[model samples]
Target: MERLTLSVTIDRPIGYDHHGTIYPINYGYVAGVIGGDGEAQDVYVLTEDDKPLESFTGELIAVVHRGDDVETKWVVTDFDVSYTADEIMATVRFMEQYFKSTIEMVD
Candidate 1:
């Protein structure tokens, strides 16, 4: 089945801190045509330091068949103290690719 992949650039780090430890947060917004069929699915995956925290998989965040039109937004606190837009985008891209690859492997 063919999958649709979309990419976006983020300029800020999305993370949060608890107690005295800081966590690196990562997230992805995915929407695509399902196997060229008329059905579509939107999904969101949020993580803390490469671990899955929460996810909306196999369905759209808002609607099931409206996956292709789904949108995702994420916020992270306490990223690196010196991160820049370029660095954040690079990190987001890496996480997005990793998530996509992992999902494909599991399918």
Candidate 2:
């Protein structure tokens, strides 16, 4: 398990999935980290709270690698939420299902 401590800011809140599907978690990106997509690394902030945030400093617990997509997403948590690879996949399946993905667990 590779546990990474990093900081991120949330741009997406719990709401519709742009396609009208409800998002159960917050999603955003690390401020300065760049990813394969040439942007700040994308991240999923797994929390049940409805509050939206501009920024959050937290930990990167895993990386979601998509076989069909050009981008990899970092899974981060601002609070005390944790999940196994399987559990994480299930939670983000709403959108991730469109792409073949594997979760690389971190400490």
List of clashing residue pairs for candidate 2: 1-107, 2-106, 2-107, 3-107
- Scored by lDDT, the top model is 2
Candidate 1: Cα lDDT at 64: 18
- Candidate 1 TM-score to native: 0.24
Error of 2 at 3 (Å): 1.9
The 0-to-1 C-alpha lDDT of every candidate, in the order given, reads 0.31, 0.81
TM-score of each: 0.24, 0.85
Regions of model 2 farther than 4 Å from truth: 48-50, 78-81
Give the local distance difference test score of model 1. 0.31
Error of 2 at 84 (Å): 0.9
lDDT tens readout by residue for model 1, 1-107: 22222332222224534354333543333334342234332233322345434432221111112233333232222322233334444444533432322121110
* RMSD, every candidate, angstroms: 13.7, 2.0
Worst 10 residues of 2 by lDDT: 46-55
